[model samples]
Target: MAVTASGVFRRTAIERADQRVSWERTDQAFFSSGACHVLAWTCRDFYPDQGIALAALYLGDFEHPLHVYARWGRWVFDASGWNLESELLQANSDFEGLPVREVETIRTDLREFCEKHVHRQPHQYWADPTERARAYVARYNPPWL
Candidate 1:
């Protein structure tokens, strides 16, 4: 997996595929994980080098938006030319004003980081993003997610 000049995700599977295959692969992942898992995975994949901000984001509850966002902006700063401001920017997207693309990107990067550094083929899609997120909180949080 590699990041493009525009800081866009260039996955190994994505880069090798022809247009149709690429679309199919991405679309498949999207449906299986929902759009949010993509973002969570991004954070999980990238930033494995370790940082408090991202850790908090991964462990932090959804009620607090800043934890995930601060790390995203930090990655944007580290990577350069990233529009980190979009961390929470909501646009009129498919899910009725869903602005999750940026977070998805972050999750993707984080996942890549984990794979490259830790060599863990961690699965992001655990049936549901919300359930998975709750599980994450459960495991990482003090008592329950």
Candidate 2:
């Protein structure tokens, strides 16, 4: 079923992921490098404190909460606070709507953040993304990220 952006469909991850992947990739799927995954989406905002991220995919899409990764083999709120798909952070999901220019800022900021964290190491592995990611996820989650 087709869904209007503002309706209940926005709250469902499956539907949302489908739309996001279609929109961004235009079916290109440049980032889907693994055979084990099924979907991906852009981020509108991320809550490291809550371990969750809000999605904003496709211009027609809206921001809403979605699961990032699991913790202790169970789904928990420990989000990674960043979406590689979007290459940005949704700093405030509560914002019902924001301009594209503002959203673009998120991408820029994210790149800067990654650079800061990745400097001073071979192959640019300065900060442990897995460990730092846990700062946004459950404590007991696998450290193998």
Q: What local lDDT does model 2 show for residue 104?
A: 21
Q: For residues 78-131, write the lDDT of model 1, one tens digit per residue.
A: 121133433323211222323333232333354564453342233433232433
Task: Highest TM-score: give the candidate number.
Answer: 1
Poorly placed runs, candidate 1 (over 4 Å): 1-35, 50-70, 74-82, 86-88, 92-145
Counting clashing residue pairs in each candidate, in order, gives 20, 7
- Candidates in order, TM-scores: namely 0.26, 0.19
Query: Scored by CA lDDT, what does every candidate get?
Result: 0.31, 0.25
Which parts of model 2 are misplaced by more than 4 Å?
Answer: 1-76, 79-93, 96-125, 134-145
